[model samples]
Target: MLSRKASCDSHGQDSSYFLGWQEYEKNPYHTVHNPTGIIQMGLAENQLSFDLIESWLRRNPDIVGLKRDGESAFRELALFQDYHGLPVFKNELVDFMAKIRGNRIIFASNKLVLTAGATPANETLMFCLAEPGEAFLLPTPYYPGFDRDLKWRTGVEIVPIHCSSSNGFRITSSALERAYQQAQKLNLNVKGVLVTNPSNPLGITMNRAELNHLIDFAIDKNIHIVSDEIYSGTVFDSPKFVSIMELAMERELYNADIWNRIHIVYSLSKDLGVPGFRVGMIYSNNETVVDTATKMSSFGLVSSQTQFLLASILSDKKFTEKYMKETQRRLKKRREMLVSGLRNAGIQCLISNAGLFCWVDMRHLLTSDTFEAEKELWKRIVCEVGLNISAGSSCHCSEPGWFRICFANMSQETLQVAMQRMKAFTDSSNSAVSQQQFVNNTRARSLTKWVFQLSSYESEPHR
Candidate 1:
């Protein structure tokens, strides 16, 4: 028998992406041995920038202290990093974040706390803000990892604010209020609201008005606001990325108190295409939160060697700027390709401006309107179609029949194949439906004819 907490730790097994990846690892599409291997479009990863990143790294060999600064500096970097993060790394990160957000936001190094990744950064914040069993309100169709990141170890709860597709899934004040009220009804203590601007799955960036509404709601309720901006640099189209830091500054000009409650989580994974590097940051104006999280970061601090290399790369103003522009250009190209391919297949995707994936509607293809039907369709797509895209249910979406399809995870060739597979699946499904309808119609007509003949015979004849 497991403890109650142990029993609750089911996110890993529950996550579709995890299961999909497991299958993919067993037989990847790129391998010759597995010709009909799975095409993994479920994980939000940016493999498009690998060539660019590799080129940049080659140009800056001194990042490893091979040329400049000698062996001593290299040795120093190889040692344990400060729990609060190396000063040089923090300074470079501050600049990198500002540059990506169009310099509209300024980050202070002292306020930054580094963790292994955004997952740990979020967990750190949850620990600092809420006690065990307390809740944070998240918008529905959120990043599925939040359940594990925020709640797994810390015992924090998530209350979802249901945003409907009718309104482009934008978070509204009414939705926030409804979630808060629902939390209250459940006797849960609501601590804060968590938002992913340039949301995961949906890939939509929240406009300024929506962000302002969030600020107002938090102020009215005196609750904390955590904005996860990990995908800040991944924005391709306009209504550009807005940082909570930028909003917090504007609010501070009038009311300084809100700064203490506003926190931002950022990472290098999506933007820099460096998930393996494990760089994540927590920037907060609250000194106490910063101090607490800094202390908590020791258990999962980034490698000193990784920090040193990234610091040097990020500090290179010219390379960093060029890299940002090129990354966005490639991401935009990939996004258009994926969206166009999906649309051509008669599949509709949510309007998304940023992020690595898009929210796709597959409801019409479902056997029914229920989540169980959604699961069945998801299974068919994975097992039959060999395309692994995440089901919206995994992301805590209120509605069924949606899935998040990652566009940047594969080569163009692989993506084309995946799209083709999706089209084939849809075509076959439609054909099956048409065949079933034809069979039903034929049966109905035969039954009607027999009934009419029987009525006519009984009326004329021998009674």
Candidate 2:
């Protein structure tokens, strides 16, 4: 028998919810032969914009260097991508980031490090920032994949800063303090705090105030702050995104140390709806982190061809600007449709303004208020209802009876079918509950009448 490392052995049983969802995708119920197909609302994907991207690509055949003038450019892009990334790619990325952040902040090419995707970017940061046993604070009800991205290989631990739903699951100072104290109690070295702005499960963007609190907390603790802003371009409403870079720039006027500790991870997967391209970047004001992560990029560098293709496309200011606007508009419309459909089914989701998914409240659907009960409900939703939405337990949500429903991954007709199934389930559940209540009421009334008759007979004189 081959002996594996202790880390691998200990974590081998820990399965990823995403990998499990893939199994469902392989032979999904919704195929041609299967009438009741599985409707997957679990994956955070943006399939809604594929047609637009494909059409644009078709219109611009020059993007592939197929044009006579672009032949040399295509050949150059087909070569090996540097660990530090192509300068042109880096330059275009900086401009794109500045544009999306409302141009309030600007990034230099030296500050950016390229990786395969945000997953590797996060793993690289974990390796660079923290030691094997150190912990990073994460706001609870976070993205489930963080476990695999940040901790699985790096040996880092995640200490959740439990955020409550009462205030829309917003991260608070008190929660930060509690998480810090809890880490201390466990005798773990707290190295940093990782936050996903335009959060994954919640789909809510953090306001300036919350960002300030996080900055202050990190400064006070003298720990690092890793801001995952992959969904920055997905914002559709108010409380617009405020990048950590912007905050650091403003603060550097008074305190320069803050800049040294801040790092950001970004990707085009969510924004461009090109997860297949696997382009991810890390931008940091900290020189040491920038250099180290750049060197670490050797393990998972973005393909040269992909970098070249994106660089050419992103450099087109007119196209990028228009694309961003249209993407947001479509996202907002889809979000509204999903919210309305769920509402019609009496399934209330947490109010969200960004990202591809929503935190749906399903506590009423659970058999009991426990993670085990949540798992059962998840099974019923997947197997019976044929809709594969993620369970709250899988996302490290402290509370049960919540799920993340991705709205941009399916067609309008498929989404409608999912809503119908959910509504049917809810209606059936309600009917069953009502019938049980009626049975209990009838039993209670019969018992009351029997007791009264017995008392009356006794009162008539010991009959």
Candidate 3:
């Protein structure tokens, strides 16, 4: 039976106050101290990636930190605008945009270009492009933002192309076809395909050859392509990162299909490891789309300082190359360390090539809802063993039995310690679950009473 706190909302929607006022009040503590946030995984980005900006500042240490209210970074705002033929006082934003007519960067295209970050970019693109009845296909268990961003921002329908543990959570062309076919039968208009290279939760980068097939498919269907290449420069141990832009740029020479229609959205944020800098580029040969996005930007306004800082950084080739290599080296080491730990503990991890995340399967233990398992898992880690991870179910995939671990922010020692804590938590959970099953056997009893039992899992084997 539902408890007094489990009553419906004012709208008669069911809500559960599982924990009392004290536990609810302590929520922020649980979230902030959690390993996912605190453990220093490499996912948060590195300062080394922004060495260019730092170097510039060091050279001009006397420069004032002023809020620049301006229109374009290319001319009036950017440091190297003059080098790129931008006159410091001239209106070169339109001219700079005109130079690149079409873009081929996967994950960084016109359909979904730059916005503070990929999240808003995805939301705006889907909102503007997806018609009232259109369906946007996403890989199951992908990024969480895709689900929340689209839902809260637009009225378009979402059609998930489910990926499963059996396939190692890798999405395939066949899956795309099936989702399209199903949407067609349901009279859903499918307008575009959005895929994340080195996907957020999965960390699986599609092979270039397979990407070509996808491009061909989109071309034939006349669907827009939104490739999230925010992680574009992060691929490790793979063939050099290949983009749809290279192929699209090539194809445009002969086919109207490849012309200024494809869009590319790139950001200095992720690869540069400076999310706070918030500088991203939208490249499109399609004048109509680029013009539309620019108009949108005029209303939204770009921070002049951010633009200048980014332009300064991008102008330095040596600075960019050095940082990129260093970041890759560090991330590679972290990935290996995490993989080794998981393996030693008998947990399975899908190895990723060029990204900061690894998607792990816990379906056997989770069995039901991915989100529910993650919610429980996160709590267990925080209250029990002091470990944390991004719940796999948060990404709006069909499955929630998986969890994603980010390697972008942590030091090696910290990661090892956190992993050990997670291992201990695993043991504690197993022990408590066994005992709780007996307490839950009674039909009339409230099984949730045992949630407190988890505190024992937290306090015992004291860290």
Candidate 4:
């Protein structure tokens, strides 16, 4: 194992990027003081809170669907007579989760367990499922949090499957098999596979048949499946989102006639648009897995208030139906707008069939240093052009040149203007090779200025 010092020297202070929580907590007020923090993708929720919710309610009064509010389902629990019996409200919440999720084949029985949100749940799963020497496989241009959370917490080996440009950032079973073969050659522990459906950053989804192949591979290898289904309900294209758990259930029922270990994790943060709620759930059929996760986290339970709110919202079928429809409509439109704009700008992106983001590949134009170059582009757009979007470098384990542009939060007009600014920037960058050369030439200018100042001081001979 590399010493922390050696790792620090190799990776440099870039490791500081992973120290997000404690560092942010220390000075979050700074961003508040700055006020110009427009369209930050770092935080999970809209800052407007009650006003936004109320406005959403007013604009579409009939859109009572609360598909994203995990706590909203529990609102009706208040009317229940007792907490125990044939129909305890909490039990209903559990059963409802099992039913809706189970019907989808996300019932990993013992393999699945719910957590506060994807982060802790993911970190816990990585720790539990992966041995110190084992390899955990994730797609390239992956979720940034998964890489950070895994390494920071468990120190396990991470294997990334880089999807090619021809494939549109989509991972195939062949890709997994190749990764598996590579892992075997390296003699890696080859513990588990982590995948996100309707993926983050890329915004693409896998079909049922595709998912089944992956599940079968995991089962055959006797390895665990870590499925991040946070965006499961946010499908934009046809075929919908098919889950590995559902595939596992199907395989157990027909193919293998035996249970396979697959773990599915979801969070209310994305779908509910109430990221602050910080509620997450995991599901699996592996008893040992669930038992271990519960023991690790059983010291505390989800907040009673949030749970009640989720219960209220979820049980309201009429509300959820309407909400989901409108949400999907808006998401689909926004995705189209962004993809179209990116295409017009000559920037290539993975076609987002589902989810709230678009994965933009900018390697053809620029390379990211600590992904800072991509962020600088966003800052330029935000500052010079009054536009805000996510940079892709934050999504993957490898140093990525991609940017994730989110369409869920911005107004249409703002999005259009942002796209125009981005187009202009790309065009200007292409035409302005001299600009970079000039900046490089100016590196010694400051030193020259300092030398002149020292000469002036020597002549003066100050006391």
**What does the lDDT read for residue 188 in candidate 3?**
90
Query: TM-score of the candidate numbered 1?
Result: 0.95
Candidate 4 has its poorest 10 consecutive residues by lDDT at 80-89
TM-score of each: 0.95, 0.95, 0.72, 0.72
The residue-by-residue lDDT of candidate 2 on 218-308, one tens digit each, is: 9899999999999999999887988877876787633557678889999999998899899999988788998999999999988887887
Descending-lDDT candidate ranking: 1, 2, 4, 3
lDDT score for residue 423 of model 4: 86
Residues 249-350, candidate 4, lDDT per residue (tens digit)? 555544442343567777777765777676776665666767777776553345545554565556666665566566667778777887899888888776
Top model number, lDDT:
1
lDDT of each: 0.87, 0.86, 0.58, 0.62
Which whole-number lDDT from 0 to 100 does residue 326 have in model 4?
A: 66
Under the 3 Å rule for N, CA and C atoms, how many clashes does model 2 have? Answer: 3
Ranking by TM-score: 2, 1, 3, 4
Number of colliding residue pairs in model 3? 30
Looking at model 2, residue 69 earns an lDDT score of 60
lDDT of 3 by residue, 143-164 (tens): 6545555654365777888776
Query: What lDDT would candidate 1 get against the real structure?
Result: 0.87
Worst 10-residue stretch by lDDT in candidate 3? 12-21
